[model samples]
Target: MAEPELALDPIFLLGAGRCGSTFQQVRLCETGNVWIWGEHSGVLAGLFRWGGEAANNRQLTKYVYPREPVSSAEEIETLQHDGRGMAWMNGFRRPDLMAAQRALVLELFAKRLPPGKTRWGFKEIRYGPADRVPLNLLRMFPAGRIVHTVRAPFASIESAIVAWELPTVVALVEQNDQAALDALYLKHLDRWNGITGYLLDLQERWPRKVRTSRIEHYEDERRELFAFLSLEAPTGSAGARIFSKADTAGGYPGIARAFAERRERFEARVAANAGRAGYG
Candidate 1:
């Protein structure tokens, strides 16, 4: 009596936090065929650790039902040897078990999306170097398309400081301590560098399935981007709402000067990432 369900072709948007992914998510969802949930990588992470009784056990109901399922910590630990536990224990190596897990997860996504949507996915900012979360997603949904968003390091760092009101940047602004400023800048730079490296690696490893997009050119290239993902491209101002408000603030002129003062030092550290992000 019920209609058959549409198969979800996942479209994952990956990047560091504050790299314009939220905006991309809005645009992609505007296509009307893509149903997306925001930042649920914790669910996938639990699946990764599900079968490993050797590791700390997390209750599946905590992730699956998420409606205050009753179980003490010790009671939850006992589940590692039960049905859901066994589903992932040797499941990763067994084709049938892996398929079951994938089906279950896909069914979970289907419940969240409204009818008539042909595809589903989510945006995750949690993955970086050495993190197995993204890898696990790829394993679960091999048919998924991965879009990595990138932004200029200077803009990302400045926006982060302004948006979060980071203490490091605040201290550097008020106190002109050269050593402290350099240290804080390097910390942000290293993080951006690591994220860029991970994106490069994903692109190389999955050339056909993975693609990089610069936030700067995203508006101009929306047509091609939609084509690559097999979605109807947005036109006019239908999907052009800019979600990130960090750059609208006026303090960047002062931050730019601070960066210029240490340009030589910062440039050397981020040269590769800048090039990869198309920020020459």
Candidate 2:
């Protein structure tokens, strides 16, 4: 008889595209238990490599997202009802590639996992991950953790410019325009902010199950983090290789610096109204 399959549900990392996703992933992968499939997980990988194919419809709402009402364009996305085909095309330009050419990148991480209990998961840079978790995979791993991390918006936006490498319409003659830069900045803000709202909802509803931690504060919470994962606390000797990289990162000092030197009057006004709509 064959051995029973190990469950493959994963704790999720919910954040924007260029916000040190690789850094967080490497940190987690070094833990020796997690199987980190970076960014190329599930049906989304289909869009990145191939053109499109209809997969099963499901909603995944356990990941982070904003708490506003869904718009018509958002409504039409239908990750559950329709599985969002256009989402696939948006990631990939090619449409007629063979399965071999467009195969899914299903990397099962096995650096130091114990046999018969290969605890692992996807390390994806995703915006709509919430659509996949609550609606689908959580059915299996109900205890899965969610880390909704964020970086300073300006830093993320500046990185996005390098990653996208394009001049906006307003910059037809001018290579870089302030308006386009601002627009991209706001877009990332909206995207990650939406993620924040979803995280709030998921945590509120399942406080014990879905916890909150940040890439910015990993160091202060290392031992607590391992306890949360149910792993034995590392001794001084093993600690060197385990948390060396994460320890040196420190925190968002730049963000604090920016917020510090800015106008406080406007901040007080904004904070008062931010939660006026309230949470779900």
Candidate 3:
């Protein structure tokens, strides 16, 4: 009788924007049974502005994170709201999105669930200073698996600026021919600090259920990522190779350099933490 409908296990794909949300999500869906919807960038586009953040998010992605942007704040004095949740224009959210988009997400996940495939996941760019979304997501799906899509900072940011449309910000903050040094430095500082802070925070709170992966090495890492998800191999899919492109013409050379620096710093952090966490 058309087999029983599958019960879905929701997945929340998070991390910085330029970190490979779209391609990763697309690859995850290659299993041919799960529903995939990763083409969203509203959260990052409006991190600096509060005007119509939810509306903007709705437009960019059918899946929404927070009910509003004003609610999410990492540096803004964190207030414990019984039901209120934090939002980030540049990242996922503080405290997580469970209390925010839980209902809608659960509903969608349930409706689009694949038969006999209870596990489901989504990829979203969570790059703002605040990033408790993964924690929030875990709460939502207690048995869910998180694919912490990461990449080298330089390559990641460079790819983000180009593939993900953060070039203008890069130009402004890189003191490129497009913007002044002050603007470039100010934004670059924010970008670097935001990314560094978020990644380190994740490492500190790295949940046992969470699986960390570097997208720059998607060819090698994606196999592990999908395998953990119990997803079929992404053969003939876009994830088979990196979206390699030469850094020619006008681009965020400064941001690219900063990304490289950030990666080095994080690599060290991971190494130190690895020992402490007994990750050999």
lDDT of 3 by residue, 1-280 (tens): 6845544455556655555655677666656566655634534324223323443566334333433444445534553342232232334443343334655555555465555445566666643345445554565566676665655544444454455445554555555443353343334335644654564565467654666566656676667677776666767546243444533124555655555545565454344433332233
Clashes per candidate, residues 3 or more apart or on different chains: 0, 13, 9
State the lDDT of candidate 2 residue by residue for 1-280, as single tens digits: 9744554446666555565556656666666556555664445433432222322112212111112334456655564464443333232122223232322322333233445336665555554534543323343346666555444443443344434533342242144344554455456455555555565566677665555554444566557756766655444432223222222112434323332333242333223213521211
- Point out the worst 10-residue segment of candidate 1 by lDDT: 86-95
Candidate 1, residue 117: Cα displacement in angstroms equals: 2.7
TM-score of each: 0.74, 0.53, 0.55
Once fitted onto the true fold, the runs of candidate 1 whose alpha carbons sit more than 4 angstroms away are 1-6, 41-43, 49-104, 237-243, 252-256
Candidate rank order under lDDT: 1, 3, 2
Tens digits of per-residue lDDT, candidate 1, 101-160, equal 677777776556766666888888777775565666676777788888888777776566
Q: Stretches of candidate 2 above 4 Å error?
A: 41-117, 129-135, 165-176, 233-280
Which whole-number lDDT from 0 to 100 does residue 200 have in model 2? 53
2 versus 3: better TM-score goes to:
3
Model 1 gets an lDDT of 0.69
Q: Which is better, 1 or 3, measured by TM-score?
A: 1
lDDT for residue 125 in candidate 1, whole number 0-100: 71
